[model samples]
Target chain A: MKRFGKLEYYFAALITITFSNTILGEGFDSTAFITIFVALTVMYKGLVVIDHFMELKEANRYLRMMMRTYFFFFPSLIILSTMF
Target chain B: MSSIESSNTLAIFPRSWSQQNAGRVPGNIPIWVGILSELTEFGIFFTAYFIAKFNYPEVFASGPLSLNTTIGVSNTVILLASSFFMAKAMSNVRRDDYKKCERYLWYTFICACMYLSFKSYEFYWNDLQGFSTKTNEFFTVYYYMTFNHFLHVGWAACAILWVIFRLRSGAYSAKEHSGLEALAVYWHMIDLMWILIFPLLYVLR
Candidate 1:
């Protein structure tokens, strides 16, 4: 479990860096695609922290749901703000 | 040890809570409550930010352009790495490896320090470029949000130091380290918040 958890962490970190480069790279335009990409990337990073790093997966259903909901809810909000 | 005796030994948390949530959550229930409250607070901040952006669309539109994207990305990576080390610390503690836990905590602290340093420089760079709270509505919220997050990271750093001290004095063990777990959860919360904040202020154009 520990080894697999470490691999998960590394994978999340690698994904974050890869997307960050795309967003921060030169002349990168923030169109609808980039906006959605950023929102999804942020959501993915938050989930990793909540579930794997915080080990909320082993937690009670309510506890896990509550924390997981934040990631989803806020990214939805971000998407809403962008559309408007 | 009797259940009661073990509960007494772990009196940092309410005995009932310790018993009730022993395997239910990652840390103390009270800390989860605090985390919930903190998340709500940030929720309010995000609402305010969006409202301000709605009111001042022009200001919001150009806000990310002036900011240093490099600094924002660096800080994001730093916090992510720091959270990783903190998680490792918790795993070590769970394995009854205090030495490895302490080492990982130090690594977390170093990453935290690097974040603070980069943030300080970012602020300095902002000042040099004549961006301040008074610069515009965007900067006003920018300063408010980042400063609030900074205070949080500052508090978490102090908590990390305290946890290290207690760990050294044998206050935590594999079986009863709710305090350490709580600290790890709190640190991860900080990281989670930054994950939201980074794009809102920097990458989202």
Candidate 2:
């Protein structure tokens, strides 16, 4: 389990670095890449880390549901508002 | 049948353990609420950023170019390191290593202080350069967001200090360390908010 957790951390770091460099480079589109990265990272933290690993889901069902609602609502609202 | 064995059993089965861990397995509501509140605040900032960008893109562009990217990047790294230490502190508490927990908490607090100092330097230099909050809408948001985050850092530092004092006074056990959990959650939230804010305001503006 610990090794798996370490692997996950490495993967996250790799993603962050790659995306960061890409965003930094000229001729790269910022909006699409940032939106994608933010969505993926937030989902990973909210669903995978907090809910699964942190055991928040088991501890507080209502809070878990509220989190799910929040993750779904806020980003989508922002994206939609930006779009139209 | 020695006195030491009896004392060991009593230590292992303290009354506080049952009382503290009884409410929920691991109470993390304080952290949950704190993060949610921060997310709302960040969302508001993002909305304002979009509004400013739509109205005056050139102004926002000039603002980011003037920022010290090196300091921003260093602060990001520092906050990430603090999160790691905060996690370690929680782990120490779980293992009933109060001394180690206090040490890690102090390290996290130091990182928080360092982050605030860098931020203060940035703000001071900006002000000396005549970039006050009244400079422009862009500078207004810049100061507002960063200053608000600084307040959070100070609050987290104080909480960490309180946790250290509690640990020293034997006020927290492995089972009853809600304070540590709360501090860790707040520390992580602070780091997470910066991860977004640094790139948005400093790098990608």
Using TM-score as the measure, the top candidate is 1
Q: Could you tell me which 10 consecutive residues in candidate 1 chain B have the lowest summed lDDT?
A: B14-23
Q: What does the TM-score come to for chain B in model 2?
A: 0.83
> Could you give candidate 1's per-residue lDDT for residues B1-205 as a string of tens digits?
7976664333565554443454466677678889989999998888888899889988987998999988888888888888888988988898999999999999998888888889999999999999999999999989998999998998899899999999999999999999999999999999988888888888776
Candidate 1 residue B70 C-alpha distance from true site, Å: 1.0
Per-candidate clash tally: 0, 0
TM-score of each: 0.88, 0.73
Q: What residue pairs are clashing in model 1?
A: none
Could you tell me the lDDT of residue B194 within candidate 1? Answer: 89
How close to the true structure is residue B70 of candidate 2, measured as C-alpha lDDT?
66
DockQ of candidate 2 against the true complex? 0.20
Q: What's candidate 1's i-RMS value?
A: 3.1
What are the per-model DockQ values? 0.48, 0.20
lDDT of 1 at A22: 46
